[model samples]
Target: MFLVALIFIIISYGMVDSLRADYAEKWQLDFQDPATPVMEGIINLHHDLWFFLILIAVFVLWILLRTLWFFDRSRGTVPSKVVHGTVLEIVWTIAPSFILLAIAIPSFALLYSMEESTDPAITLKAIGHQWYWSYEYSDYTTDSESLAFDSYMLPESELKEGQLRLLEVDNRIFLPTHTHLRVLITSSDVLHSWAVPSLGVKVDACPGRLNQASIFLKREGIFYGQCSEICGVNHGFMPIVIEAVPLKEYVSWVSSQIQI
Candidate 1:
């Protein structure tokens, strides 16, 4: 009865609204709703693995309880001297091997899919600084035109109503929904990480190395993230905001930026 109730609670937790960030909720119990295809795939894989985890946990707990109940001092006067059976050993070994194989197949498929970024429509170069992020939009403006900007964390005092403290930024990276994007990440100083949980993006930013990742937006919304790797004193202040919009709005935003 307890196990059934636990499962029901988990299912109810996942069914809650995922589009908006729930600041008041606990972290370990829920996953922020996914906005991208990669995030969706990740959520699916996590639920798939949970099934195996629950099965193994229940089996181990049952074995432990059975042993304590049947073989305790109050229940047994003499210890059994039987050795391990060959059939039991073979079954344990083969069953685990098959279970592993079942897990590996889907794991490999998801890994390969992440690496497969075909024909990207836009490319964004993100350079990490000691405590902020700068981005350049490629494939939109010509060589003479400059389409770059710095994104700094908005101080708590400047944040308006409903804005998240330490998570909102002055400038947001914008992109169009249903478009494939290639993001090149690097660091100007120490090591940093470009991470956003909703987008399923977490690429390391090395000083002299360029790391690439793919992002495909399935919907239009505001997504937030922070630096995953600790680089300096204000690492927590470096926030990332992505404003995904429609294609027409995105083009207009580009034109306005170019004009500015």
Candidate 2:
């Protein structure tokens, strides 16, 4: 019974670790859990590239080892008069070309998919300031007043139990799952970046220029990100949190916000 309980505990801990990827973890070696299709594709492409990289690395290592073994100084082998082999050179060149072609095809395909424009059901505008983010729901307005709010990181004193220290925010961007959403990012002052790894979005927020990206949430969770670009002294304090909820819950939240 004791052994069974220990095994169960280990398995449970591993499962929890794998599922908790919305926020940054200590000593994290992999990407955060994917909450959108774009992130899923990004992870898949990364794995595919790793496969090719491993193959190339192994082949190079084998060639190096073979050469070292065959050309050892102790063996005193006679040197061949041939300077180079055309067949060998051609094989190395043509092999890389084919490998490059294989890599390029999928890379281009993923890039196109990422840049493809789509009609969005909801559009949100994010404006970055010195140390905080301002969001506006451009799609919904009442009496010329649109739903907008500023998100600031919660200080350590204000954080509750189980809340992340630098990652928690007073207000989080709430959106509906399985909905096509467009986010327009720009800066009110210096350059900033609106990045959320789970959603696979990293758009530069530049002054006088607006950048747009598409997001389609596939799950419900709180995803966290930080300003990737160095904007000011408090850039590290500016964090982003997004909460994906069901359609009905999102609508209710929206209604409540508009009322406020």
* TM-score of structure candidate 1: 0.89
Candidate 2 residue-wise lDDT, 76-147, digit = tens: 976689999999999999999998998899889888888887899999999999999999998889999889
Q: Write the per-residue lDDT of candidate 1 for residues 106-207, one digit (tens) a residue.
A: 889988888888788999999999899999997767557659999999999997656777887899999899998999999999999999888888999999
* Pairs in clash, predicted candidate 1: none
Model 2, C-alpha of 253: deviation from truth (Å): 0.2
Cα-lDDT of candidate 1: 0.86
Measured by lDDT, the strongest candidate is 2
* Model 1 CA lDDT for position 6: 76
* lDDT by candidate, in order shown: 0.86, 0.90
Give the residue spans of candidate 1 off by over 4 A.
1-28
